[model samples]
Target chain A: MKKVLIAGASLTKVGDHWNKSLLDLAVEAGSAALKDAGIAIPDQIVVGNMFSGFSSLQENLGAIIADSLMLQGTPALKVESSGASGAMACNVADSIIRSGQANSVLVIGVEKMRDMEPNDAVHAASLGESASFTQFFGISQTAMCALLTHLYMQEFEISRDELSVFPVIAHKNAVPAEHAQFRKAITITDVSRSMPVSDPLRLLDCAPVGDGAAAVVLCSENGQTKNAEAEISASAASTDSLNFFQRDDMFDFTATRRALAKALAFAGLSIKDIDFAEINDSYSSVAALSVEALGFSKRGEGVRDAKEGKFDLNGKIPISTFGGLKGRGNPIGATGVYQIVEAYRQLTGTAGANQVKNAKTGLLHNMGGIDSSAAVHILRRVG
Target chain B: MSIAYWRERNRYYRILGSKCKECSAEFFPPVYKCRKCNSEKLAEQEMPKEGKVMAYTLSRDIITGFEDQEPMIIGLIELQNGVKMVAQIADASADQLAVGDKVKAVFRRVSVNGEAGQIFYGYKFVKIDK
Candidate 1:
């Protein structure tokens, strides 16, 4: 298979884009990425989005975005896997380029979540889980994560303060990120004292809803652009039971573990080889489970390690280099691509204050619906 | 929402799940195939009503049709037969709920489609006083 390289990337600051429409965000990010790559048009376009129809009353996003970008006549499509839509789109683009089907591909991840009412937005996000079994009972996604948090603490004997460290680190890292949504650092006391959206899961424990878009240009290894500095070494996806309660062990994120293992094997690297990581911390507990599943920490040690400064910027295997879902703002479908673009920034020495010194390799973990679906990508710096 | 809810009424009303005919292992919310033995030969079985609270959460951000039911308590209950299922904890306050507390299933209104849509009913759990 031919290797795929990220030629260029761009992102919009994540927040309430009351002035911008969904299509506007897409065009802005896509155009910026294309301009950065010095390409007039891409061979194909793939959009990753979660709920354009529900939030913006817009579907057929691919055609709309392509037409608005004035890149008509290109083969355009959209891929949705709940929160993992962004990474899934990138995976599709990678396959298209690796199979020699397309020489250049523009992958865009965009979402307009702030356009809808708070209740409607929560309902749309809960659609990521099972409609018949999970959502029928009217349990929001935050409630489910809160239950998982309670279980994790009870099972592993982890204290509330230890669990609160993930968001603290995320907010701290996000302070230096220009494109991050929550740039101000937050204290652990703030996380613990915040309003309880779901008991045991304060408001600060969850990623804020926002409008944002991120785009990346992918090309075959030999067809690199002038700014191309990183090659996608491995790309893989995996799935688990849709209902979190149905899994044998509710705390074990099987999809993340499977996908990350396959990605590392494909890249011929191990967990230790990863210099920096962009993990899916849509919720604080989810972040802990993700790191444990990815082998960065032993089982039941993820939150403890974070509290011990193991996941800090200068610590072993730095994660969430540019804020994360918690601090960076999670645009649902757009979050995965944000992670990819952030990794590209880290590997290319353009991460600014968030840069990890001598970073050579990085990993990106994005998931949909509490690890129901996950996509893992491994990238390495290329000269 | 009404059609899907009606189609699985038995599963919701009586806690009817699937039991593997080969191994006799049971599951809640049903399953396409046996998780234990991977056997497609499965039969519908009513799950035990009594269980224990393995974990629980109280949610203030209500979903659509659940606005009137804010601060809802949901729990993961482990049945007598080992099948685990998620359901709302009815008639209970945070102070009265705890892990390992005994609970029994009871039929109640789950939610309504909209202001004028059909009301969906399902099994909910109530703590059994010691």
Candidate 2:
């Protein structure tokens, strides 16, 4: 397989884009990517979308996006793995380039979640649950995470003060982004004051529903016609049981651990070798769990690391320099790709205000449908 | 009252999943097809009415069809049948709950679509009172 490099990337400010249709966002982001790469068109295109069928009541995204860009008949397709659809699309694009099937490919991830009412969106997302299992019992995603947070507390004796540290850091990091949704830095006291969404989880603790799109251009070494941000150092993905019940443990994500391990191994590095990271923070409790699972600290001690400012931009290893899904907004399918874009910007020194100091290697971790599927990628600076 | 086959079988108690004889994959609300191996051979199985609370949460922003049930405690419980299921946490405040705590099942009205609309009923878990 040939080595693949990211030629260009682009995105729109993530928020309520009610006036824009699904195809509009795709074209906007897709155009920005082509301009960034200095390429008019790619040999093939892949789009990542999770809920256009229900939220917008539309389908045939491959055709819609391709037609809008005036790149018709360029061999287009759509990739979906629930929330991780963006990263999944990137993975497919990379594979195509490495296999000599396509010299260059355009991978775009977009989700228009904020267009619908809050409850309507929640119900639509809940369809990811097993119809005969969790959905039949009427369980929603917030409740599912709240349940996991409660379990983690019971097992580790986690303190509310501990869970309080993540949002504090996230809001602070996101404040200067200018494009972030919740840009105001928060305090532990504020977290406690927010209304409870679920026991042990407050309204502020959950990621907000937002709309956004991100795009990446991947090409083989031979196809590089312009300077780009970075190269695909390594990437690994794994799957797990969709329902949380089948897993032997709630706090532990076997897929995440395995994928990270494989990724680190492929990159010929370890956790300590990573200069920064972007982990899935669909909920505050998840941020606390992922830092520990990624070997930043012990399982129960992730909260301690956050409290000490270990994950801040200037600390030992910064995480989510883009405010993450918590403060930046969770745009479902577009989230994972957005994280990679942030890392790429940081490594290339393109991040205006949120850039880490002389960063080299960065890690990206995303979980799809609770813990059912996971994708981890390692990026390096080559520019 | 007329109901779906799965709902009809669960009217007397909480719904349980049975694994297919041709494929040993268990399902909740019982199913005729095997999720794996796709075999018609199946066996009837009852879900344990009592289990340990594995995890839980309380949702404040309620959905449209479940506005009245706002701030509800939802949980994952491990049944004696070696399966885990998500259900509502009934009969207790958020503070009284913990992981691994014993809980029993009870039928309860989950939500009402409208003032005159159909009332949704399902099994909810309550702490086992000493």
Candidate 3:
């Protein structure tokens, strides 16, 4: 099998880009990434997005973005797996390269969230859930996660303060991250007392809605491998029940656990071998469950371990190296690509203050819905 | 939204779901195939109306069409038939709800699409007095 290498990566600062359209953000990041890769045009282009049609009233994103980038003739398309869209794009690009079909591929993940009203945005986000079952009842995704958090707390006897630690750590790391949305550091007390969006999930506990774009240039192993900062060692994805309540164990994220295990096995590594991880921290409870699913902590002990600083930058296995979804701002479809870009920065020694010292191998976990679909990628620095 | 809600009127009105004839396993929201046995032989069965709150949340940030219904209590209820589901907890305050509180499903208005649009109705749970 031909090895796939991440030739270059770029990201726009994640926030409410009211002035810029979705196409503008994609062009900015895509052009920068292409420039970074020293390639004028790639063999193919893949766009990862969730709700442009619903939020921006724009569809046919693939050709639109391709034409905007001045690569009109390129074979381009969009991949939508809700929040994991970005990572799924990368996974498809990897397959294209490995299949000996395309030597180079440009993967772009972008989301336009702030353009819609808050309630509308919430409705758009809920499109990822089971529309007939979950959304028809007027329950938002946050409400589902809140119920999950409540169950987790009840089952494990975890305190609100302990769960608050995840967001605090995210904000702390975001303080030094330039492209992060909320760079201001927050404390556990602030998270605990923050106005509740859904009971047990305070405002700070959830990833803020924002607009952003991230792009990565991938090429088959050859000349690109010489300059590549990280090699795509492994890529895998898995799925579970669309509705969270249908699962036998509500707290168990079987998709994430399965994806991680498969990706790690492909890379011939264990969870302990992971230097850092970019787990999906869409919600504080989601973060805890993800950590536990990845085997970083014992079952029902993810929050406890997080409170003990096990997931800090210098802890046993650091996570959310670049503020994660919480502080970095979750641009939905763009978030998975953001994780990959951040990993590239860390491996290439460009992550400045947020860099984990001597970090070599990193795991990127991106999920859609409530861990309904998960994409796990393992990247190792290959100088 | 109205059409979709209308399609599932039976499920919403009477808690109708699918039960696997092969294994006798039941599910809410209906499944095409049995999850446990992977059998396509399934039948429409009405789910139990009463259940206990496995988990609950009072959500202030709701989706569109639910703007007027802020701070809504939503619960994960486990029915007596051993099927769990998400439903809005109605006529109950935060102080009145707990993890183990028994509740029964009642048909209620879910949301009003627009000023003069269709009023969608669904099952909402209310705390059952001991």
Candidate 4:
């Protein structure tokens, strides 16, 4: 894979942005990234989002955001793969730069989820699942995850407190993360006792609904953007059964596992080379399954390992360094870009308190709809 | 029924799925290409109604249209012929459900468009007792 450089990166704090529209958040993050890169305009623009038509009552985000940024006539488009939209957009940007079609490409991942009514947001998010089969029955994504959560705990013989550890670690990590939505540290009891969205899966176990945007500017090996902080070594994505229950091994995060394997192979690196990871913890079970899929812990032991402090900032193979989807807040599609921006900060030594020691390599695992689709990218610091 | 559900009435009511001719593999929510043998030769098959509850959840965070069905119990069921599906676990409360409990399909109203609109009917699972 060509070493596409991350010349600039920026993000709006993940939380309720009552005063901003969808385009406002996109332009805010997009302009900051271009300014950081000292570029007047990118050769191409790519926006990653999910359910904008439902949340913002707006579509054609590509044209609208390009015009808003005053970069009309520039080639622009949008890519959506549910929650993996951001990483998938980045993957597209990397391919564009490597293909020599564009010298520089700007990728903006934005979502306006907080503006809608609570149930409407749930409905919008539910669109990520199979409409006729899953969503048609009124089982929201949270409900879908909850069904899996029950099986996971029961089959693995994991106690409630053990399953609650992933959120606990996420909250603790978010305490020092300035851009995180929830900065308050929490305990296992807090997670276990949180209001149940679906039985056995509490509110804290699920990622909070919020609004956010993140952007990154990618320049090719010899592109004019000279402010290269980190290089994207590999980008890989894979798909699984859209219905989680349909999969042969429901606990196996096939997409995440396959994507990570493909990404590591493409980068000529191994799991050992990854210093930290930014995995989608949309639910605690998803987080645990993803960690296990990434080979950080053995099967059915991801939560237990997390409970033992293995995924902490100072511990082995730290994950969700910036609170992840849980503590950092999940603006649906924007969460993946948030992971990339946070990883860029860690690699560039800009991560003040959430920084991992000697973090030379990082992995971003973004999944949509219960690991139905997954995108994994491995980033390494520039020399 | 809405036009969309009207079109898929057979699939909804009969559990119509795909069965690959080459590999003898069956799937719910039918696949275009057979995952087992990559066979495009497939036939529509009705899935077995008898199954066990692989998992279940009492869901409170439902989508807007389902406000009337607050806190619904949904189950992940594995049909007898070795196919998995998600169906509402009707006629049973959360306390009565358990993993590996036998269940069978029952026809029921799954969703309603509104007061004067369409009523989408489909299969719902009921416990087959201990």
Question: Where in model 2 is the C-alpha error above 4 Å?
Answer: B1-14, B19-42, B91-102, B108-121, B126-130
Pairs in steric clash, model 2: A147-B56, A197-B58, A198-B58, A199-B58, B17-B27
- Tens digits of per-residue lDDT for model 2, A120-177: 7886666666654555445677777777787787788888877888888888889988
Candidate 4 residue runs with Cα over 4 Å from true position: none
Output the worst ten-in-a-row residue range by lDDT, candidate 3 chain A: A221-230
How do the residues A108-165 of candidate 3 rate in per-residue lDDT, one tens digit apiece? 9999999999998988888999887778877899999998888789889999888899
User: How big is the positional error of residue A273 in model 2, measured in Å on the Cα after superposition?
Assistant: 2.1
Higher-ranked by TM-score: 2 or 4: 4
Worst 10 residues of 2 chain A by lDDT: A129-138
TM-score quality measure for candidate 3: 0.98
- lDDT per residue for candidate 4 within A253-330, as digits (tens), equals 999999999999999998998899998898998899999999999999998889788999999989999899999999
lDDT of each: 0.91, 0.80, 0.91, 0.91
DockQ ranking from best to worst?
3, 4, 1, 2
Which of the numbered candidates is closest to the native, going by highest DockQ?
A: 3
Clashes of each: 0, 5, 0, 0
**Residue A71 error for model 4, in Å?**
0.2
- Model 4 lDDT at residue B99: 86
User: What DockQ results do all the predictions give, each relative to the true complex?
Assistant: 0.78, 0.51, 0.83, 0.82
- iRMSD, model 2, in Å: 2.4
